[model samples]
Target: MFIESAGNSLRTIPGSFAVQPTSLQALFSKLPAESLSAGQTLILEGDVATSVFHVVTGSLRIFRILGDGRRVITGFLHAGDILGMSFKSHYIYTAEAITPVTIRRLSRKSFENEIAVSPDLGPAVFHQMSDEMAAAQDQMVLLSTKNAEERLCSFLLKELQRTLNAGALQTAVQLPMTRLDIADYLGLTIETVSRTLTKLSSKGVIETAGRHSVKILKRGKLAQMAGDGDEYEDDWRPATPQPERIRH
Candidate 1:
């Protein structure tokens, strides 16, 4: 069954697994559950890919350091997301918890053994991999072609969809990641992200519920800015009167 939390909806672990719950549970019953505090490193770059994680709660940030020691955030893994799938022996990027997290760890050998018995598992894994790849490609386009405003808009729209899925079209979405995390992911400076969000707020495209929550007031306009077209116009409604604008 699905439940809403932190402004996003998520399924139970079994449902989220995208496989027969009984089969998945029986296949990895020996694996233990692990917990990490916020900001704790779950997996480091270049570490052996011994196990894959299934997120039961919270989120993780995947990032890498450049030659100059600058951090580049690749993406975030939310509740129900999987991590540590690698073709190589080692992981390419580090993964850390953005919030207190709970995960189920399945060793690679065990995972492979299960797949050997259930050939259908291979296709499910492939589908998950393909979804992640498509998201990566979309990020590439956002970074290469979009301006700061467009990038932020695209990020907000995409995040809403990822977290809320069907409810994303019209809802107040909570951003689990910080502004700095978003700046890193979008390849923009913190100041630029703040500015873009301020501009959006001033224009009544969005309203700030708090530091981390945003009510998308003009989904149609925001969608258009994000290059998603105006098909969302029918769902658009006048925004609530915003508070006095404050310069960041």
Candidate 2:
């Protein structure tokens, strides 16, 4: 179900935890939406963790800058993804927009208040955090054991799955981040990332749709190369089976 507020909309994906519309409305009504241009920094490392952000549209890159000035990308956040759930007072990574984006900002205090008052919101947050933790563990496996080809294949399949789950019908998966960002996230060099993508396109496993998109052509083969028996299996499932009610 979808909820619309101030010309921006939010929807919960099927097969995932559902937060009641009333809870979401109460939470979001206290927050304001902001628009950001590509390359804009939303939050910086060492900054106070005062608020959390919900991606209403576009994508964000979460990364940490090392002392030597190397940027290590931790993950990518797409539409419906939430960030700033750190238990520490300061953020460890910086969040930057990869494309023109719209985001709703909920202060830490407001979020805690909502969770305390709304029973559904607390469990929904917990489920989302658990899902993120599982994803991080999978990424660790990819970085530690998977080869370059396998890593690229895994990344593509996961992105395709995420796009599909977001209700996108097209085969093209939007890649708003730069090659450097992807390289950092996958623990590969930029050259390796470019070469692997080129190889995949040539092999007909995928096709390049301009600079910022890819279309998967041979999903089964790609999944095999990633060492997964089938297409990317998601661990994210709804905490409850109840139908989501949209609040107008």
Off by over 4 Å in 2: 1-26, 231-248
Report the number of the highest-lDDT candidate.
2
How does each model score on lDDT? 0.67, 0.69
* Local accuracy of candidate 2 as per-residue lDDT tens digits, 121-184: 7776666666667777998999999999899889988787777666666678888888888899
> For model 1, how does the per-residue alpha-carbon lDDT over 211-235 read when each residue is reduced to its tens digit?
7888888878999998878756636
In model 1, what is the error at residue 183, expressed in angstroms? 0.2
- Model 2 earns a TM-score of 0.82
lDDT of 1 at 5: 20
Error of 2 at 81 (Å): 1.3
Residue 35, candidate 1: alpha-carbon lDDT: 65
TM-score: model 1 vs. ground truth: 0.81
